[model samples]
Target: MKFALTLVSGLLFNSIAQAGVGTELVADGFERPVWVGAPDSVKGKIWVMEQAGTVWIVDLKTGKKAEEPFLKIVPKVERKGNEQGLLGLAFAPDFAESGRYYVNYNEKGGETQIVRFVTEDGKTTDPDSGETIFQYDQPYANHNGGWLDFGPDGLLYVATGDGGSANDPKNLSQDLGSPLGKLLRLDVTGKEGYKPAEGNAFAGVDGALPEIHAFGLRNPWRCSFDAETGDFWIGDVGQNAWEEINVVKGNKTGGLNFGWRLREGDIKTPGRKGKEIGGKIPENYHAPIYVYAHGSGGTQGLSVTGGYVYRGSAVPDLKGRYIFADYQNPRIWSLREKGGKSTDFQDHTKALQPDGGRISLISSFGEDASGELYITDLTGPVYKIVEK
Candidate 1:
């Protein structure tokens, strides 16, 4: 049985020229931007992380962007080629007081590292407060997990891609010892820096990172917590055949292995070599709640760029919808469940990158203090998803 549902009464469709749900370009003039963070401590300001390692601060209320890049670590850091560099950021849940935050970036050696830093007087100049929270090696560049958020449980959850270079090599997705291809739960609120969150199912398990909450995933390109339910939605980009979205709710057992090399979507296969002899695997290794073919429509394909569950009041029609986009194309789609089966409800690509820019490559989607969705175009500008 497929667990999917469609919440909207009528689908809001669009074409290449025009969009339906009114997405006004709130900001522009970004250079190869990939991620955005709306830190509440900054008075509802949105911070954007550029591919070149600079963070741009945009004031949401004033429609003004800081003249100087908020923070620039790129000059010293190496971004050799694609799928690397600054990727994710989040303000500490208690940012108003501490003015502390975290960052996700890949080094010149192609390893993913999460670091904690404190801005000096709300400015990003000479950040002398840098602390290494955690670091993981990436075998390839493409699948470095791109988003981080503090869950309702107050644990910091970080997403790491399957050790990259196409096709899971180390099979880290199912290997508990590896942090690759998993959602990690870490206790960063302590004086000890980042430790495994207590009560994590694998915390005491030998040969494990103790921070892992779930495994068996491809590139979890983007993941976010549901506003109302606090459930997690991971858009794991698939290889060649299938794309999947996995749901992880709070306080559940820390081990739901979303099938990857063993099977793509719900299709059972013995191996990635394309053997189809497997009967039925354990239900424990679950399939996607929603799946799509690479040749679905529009671009006829979409690589996962996971986004937030809409909680913005501006778009009452999209209150609970999951908004996501593809990396190869400018097309954006919405997924909602109806009768336990998820369906693509709308296509809002026409309004995306409205300036007709190339390389729409959406690396991440962001949410403000008010819970509105903001998208970062890899080689473009940060856009706010507003109602039409």
Candidate 2:
């Protein structure tokens, strides 16, 4: 493990020296844009994903959305619920040479599909060329944990939610047999359509699926790996009392069980009844790095929206801190990770919300090939992090 950290079950109350960072509008006029990113080989452009089944290419220099979408599969996509639709996209490591990319979307009958497509010119891809490499049925619509990306190891990592209901009705998070409620590692090549990524935790284990890398997640919203350190970071949305941020350091990559159903944030999940509602908490559960209480209203949490660690040249103060926020509350914050503890905690909410603009509904955060960070709010605006 490259890091060591304990879980924090309550709100951070430290008022330390602030990181001099803010956001500027990068592009606007998108429809429920859920993610934005670009391949390392590509520069000056980023692809934005709309939850309603569209991928748009935006020019960073012009700050304009592309006239035509890079990818569209709305007719095949089933976007009936709030959580279902085209949720993620990742360009292959060798995308510059191979022009291959992948997407994660929900099918008509509530199935999660991982499809691969080839782009001749790297600008657009034909839906006809897309092939579903992996698929699985989703029991419910709400907790469709749809986030996928290529890690530093060039393997595809996917986040999935537990069988969705209050307090994990089926307790799928702890079930080794199911792929639900787990982070999956997959390898994709020309010959092997889709298989377990090498060194996956359950590759040779009996009964468990080989694709599983880490298990026991409630609804991981948006996650990213530190471009510099390779450490994994995620914002796992909580059920009742809290919202959390979890980190698994770089060198150690598999066999992690983040307690859910049985544990939310750092405490036992408080369900409709009490903490006794879910099953037993494991002896050695991997706890969240940070947790915060619900935003006043008990109805929904300040749902966590995970973001990347800033490594761009523009912001020296925010150079190595992990920045993240919530959906319902939408207040952004940054904290330094040292010795497995969060220090130098700074609230970047006021600074990020520029000139009376609101980032009220954060869907996800993005990073381009240049290591700059961007935020995608469900409402339409995509903002870039800048020195303020």
Best by TM-score: 2
TM-score of every candidate relative to the true structure: 0.87, 0.93
Off by over 4 Å in 2: 1-19, 297-301
The residue-level lDDT of candidate 1 at 164 comes to 77
The residue-by-residue lDDT of candidate 2 on 202-267, one tens digit each, is 888889999998898988888898998999998888886778788888726588889987888878
Error of 2 at 170 (Å): 0.6
Deviation in angstroms for 178 in model 2? 0.7
Q: Assess candidate 1 and give its lDDT.
A: 0.71
Residues 1-388 of candidate 1: C-alpha lDDT, one tens digit per residue: 0001212234333334333465556577777777776765454688877877888788886767888876788854447756677877878888777777888888778778788887766766564457888988887767777578788887888888887775676667778898898878888997647888888767778898788877777777778888788878888887766667666654363777777666666665335466443335554675566665566466335577778789878778677888877676456777675444565456667654454554266777888878888887765667777766
* Clash numbers, per candidate: 14, 0
The list of candidate 1 runs beyond 4 A from truth reads 1-20, 41-44, 250-253, 269-283, 338-340, 351-359
Best by lDDT: 2
